[model samples]
Target: MKPFYEKTIHTKPIFQGRMISLQVDEVELPNGQTSTREVVKHPGAVAVMPFTTDGRMVVVRQFRKPLEKEIYEIPAGKLEKGEDPASCALRELEEETGFAAESLQLVTSFYTSPGFADELLYIFEATGLTQGKVHPDEDEFVEAQLISLEEGLELMAAEQIHDAKTVFALMYWQNKRLKAQLGK
Candidate 1:
């Protein structure tokens, strides 16, 4: 694996924005050749799978401009510089869904799209939720909904829940349930 590594020779910034930046890197390929790779750098993010006391999951419905339609997804937001993922998860859950979790656990973390982007997302499972006032970002227009895990899966099958983070979170939640049922 080390023999196949591409070492970065130089990086040229193409664009920089508040949320993401684009860069092109000149790399020394494993085969002794040089190539350019375009990459998108992001500030990573956190996604929360909030479960209520009655076994319902809290999700958010919002219009995604890139998709040009509304979609349902777990509460998520980009991490502030130097912010811990768990803290970001809790903040996003409360801000978007108006529910604060009494118990929040880190389930996993992964890069959303490693082929071209470096945006990693930390996923958390939150339980024992208490309702509060929603304080979504001024630019964020989101409405929270509570649904059973079964319903969440159904929505996924219907393509209504299409975001990667939400899909992964729901699948993780279901896998945990199956494991519990099997006593594994």
Candidate 2:
């Protein structure tokens, strides 16, 4: 086995926005070759899989500008520069679903798109939920829906719930359901 790393020789900033920034980097490969890499820098984010007392999952349907369509997804938000992911998860849940959780647990964290973007996403599971007033960001428009496991699968099959985060939440939710059914 051998180690392969790209050393950045120069970086040119392309654009900076509230959520993300874009840059192009000149790099030296381990094989002594040079190339340019386009990198997207993000502030990371958090997602929450919220379950109601009745076992239905809480999802929000919103219009995504990039996709030019609406999609259903778990409650999620971008992280502040030094914010705690768990806190962000709870906040997003409440803002998006009008639910506050009494129990919140971290499930997993992963990069959304490692090849181009440096966006780390922390996924969480929230239970013991209490309904509250809906309060999404002024620029954000979403409608919360409670769906059964079968409905979730249907949505996934229909590509209504197309993001990786929501798919993962559904799969994890199913695993938990199975474990409980088997008394695990």
Candidate 3:
């Protein structure tokens, strides 16, 4: 058996929305105790860090309802049913930033919040970006921003880049920079 496994005894679906589903689960703990878990099920997502040929990083600023604020972040979107992560990344890049990537490389895949949510996020580093048409979703209102890598680092240090995926992508970029400098 897996470590600290919780066997679900019952699951009560609370709400089913377009992007996520909420459920309350009654689970039996490994030590034979029963507990309740409020879980958020998400259909996964993809985030891209696109860098222009001129070395500027493309980001987006949008108003988030949950945060009740406009924040800058890397381009990202949810994965549609039966959609691959790379495809989702490319689509989001073009739709949100008006840029198409000539080279799309997967950086990593991670769970956004493993404590109470099952939302997996796939991150990619996109280079050789070319200007394209902007076409975001009907409900999405995004403003693209192109900044240097140093500016992105400053934004993160100023606590402006708050999202997990965006932060991780930036870290990935930093690591790539280090590796390149080290001639690895």
**Quick one: best lDDT, which candidate?**
2
lDDT of 3: 0.90
Q: Please, what is the TM-score per model?
A: 0.95, 0.98, 0.95
lDDT for each residue of candidate 2 in 45-84, tens digit (9 for 90 to 100): 9999998888899999999999999999998999988999
State the number of backbone clashes in model 2: 0
- Residue 90, model 2: lDDT of 89
Maximum-TM-score candidate: 2
Model 3: number of backbone collisions:
0
Query: Which stretch of 10 consecutive residues in model 2 shows the poorest summed lDDT?
Result: 89-98
Q: What are the lDDT figures for the candidates, one per model? A: 0.93, 0.94, 0.90
What are the RMSD figures for all models against the true structure? 1.3, 0.8, 1.4
Error of 2 at 29 (Å): 1.1
Worst 10 residues of 3 by lDDT: 167-176
Q: Give candidate 1's error at residue 164 in angstroms.
A: 1.5
lDDT of 3 by residue, 1-184 (tens): 5699899999999999988999999999999999999999999999998987776788899999999988899999999999989998999999998998899998788999999999999889899888979999998999999988789889888877888887886777788789989999
Q: Write the per-residue lDDT of candidate 1 for residues 27-98, one digit (tens) a residue.
A: 999889999999999999999989887778899999999999999999999999999999999999999999
